[model samples]
Target: MLATTRNTLIQLAEIQHQLQTIHEFFNKWQTNPWGFKEEYLSEKVLVRFLKYETESFANREWEAHRKEIDLHIILQGSERIYLEDATKLTEGIYHEKEDYYLLEGPSNHFITLSSAIDQENSLFLWPTEAHKTGVNVTDEAVMVKKMVFKIKY
Candidate 1:
């Protein structure tokens, strides 16, 4: 789960270089939808495609991916993402393969993420960060545009 400002993402040339690979993959399924898949680009990074239906709320326990940074980009719809500091993560078991740990306790604080009004870019998430993404309680289908790229620290 990656979340951050657009400017921050553009500054990372390594990430910018990989955008083409992501775009190529996104172009294949823009008309359709699917779930997460690992697209290996090289030893330094891997692109992950994720699709989730928009709903009132989505609470998830993520497997920890230590030392890797996540780049999240929205490709279709709009939704809010909540992120909390991993140090405050007091719950959830570690699933090494998935690369994120679930949080059982109440989150202390969170950063909110929504669609970019100006451009399409990726949001970066540090390793061990705990986060949640979805729409608020409402009766509508929210199309979420996103891409998660794993980067080695």
Candidate 2:
């Protein structure tokens, strides 16, 4: 898993290049809803712009993908994301269409992200990493808008 910001992007050309199309996509959808056509980034990449109320960490499940990497960028609010080694978790059957596997048990650690930090605050999870997102940082549930870029691996 990789946690970074826009400030560090210039130094990560190899990774940033994979996300180049998102910059224009963000600009074009500033006022648009979360929905978009499947595979917006390219033939294999799927971009999901989602907005939802933050939930308790206990309510979220740890999920890992087999063929895609998860790129999470917080655009509107704050949330804590928990990550764990997929190999350590009890895995459920993989969902081919969604490209993710359901994992049981807690995570090894977590990180928090918010829009105030920077528009580029992002987290990338590889196929071996399981993560639980949408957990609130504070006591109250806040609405969070985040973009999930599913890049084919």
Candidate 3:
């Protein structure tokens, strides 16, 4: 798993893509609802824009992907995201088409959503990591707008 900012994403030579294309396209998606649903940024990269309210983790299951890297970029609001090693969690039945499985266990590590203020607004989770997201930062609920990039590796 990796944690970095959007601008840093472009500077990393490791990720294969036209950085300008993604940055430009991202700006467009942030402003218009027409670009809301999941869309392909490249042959192996897909982006999904979503908005929802933060909630308690009481009964929610952590999730891990088998075939993609999840990069979550928070556009607005704040929340806490819990992440843990996949091996520490109990096994879960896999859903072939969706490519993910829900895990059961406690998350011992987490990162509160960062923004422009911290220069690290994005979190990356690979197949080796399990995470429970959309968690409230406080007792009060907060609305969040985020973009998730699903990249097959």
Candidate 4:
């Protein structure tokens, strides 16, 4: 799923960083698994794998990026991702080299991401769109394996 209310330059970001390497991984995820390794697809594209159990909203933190557009692909299990506009959230300390800052606010909008549940199976989050991921979809916690493609813009 994609949210655009936070920033209208989302289209520009996508066009500049076409996400070509990400598509390659999409086709070879099963045949050529990269495991849980951090790989640099190119100078502009990067690959990261994460395995964790979904936790409560309060336990997680909201974050927004300034340099890259995040493409979250769920490989196994399910998670609820909450999104909020950065303009409305209170900003915390930012990691300069990392290009991200913590956000604190309420988010009433979200989507459930899972291999079996979502038809798209992937989600795109651009700059200024604060997101709190790894959220539990139900009452119980479930382990999720996800691949994140950081498309620099």
**What TM-score does model 1 achieve against the real structure?**
0.63
Top candidate by lDDT: 4
Per-residue lDDT of model 4, residues 1-153, tens digit only: 334563556565555545656776668777876565788878888888889999999999999998888989998899999999888999998897887899999989998898785355678887888999999989899999988888777
TM-score of 2: 0.79
User: Could you say which candidate leads in TM-score?
Assistant: 4
Clashes of 3: 0
Order the candidates by TM-score, highest first.
4, 3, 2, 1
Query: lDDT of candidate 3?
Result: 0.79
Query: Each prediction's Cα lDDT score?
Result: 0.62, 0.79, 0.79, 0.84
Judge candidate 3 at residue 106 and give its lDDT.
84
Q: Total clashing residue pairs per candidate?
A: 15, 0, 0, 0
lDDT digits (tens) for residues 1-153 of candidate 3: 556787756645555563444677778866874745678888767888888888998745789998887889988898789999989999699897878998898865888985558656888776758999989878989888888888776
RMSD of 4: 2.8
Greater-lDDT candidate between 1 and 2: 2
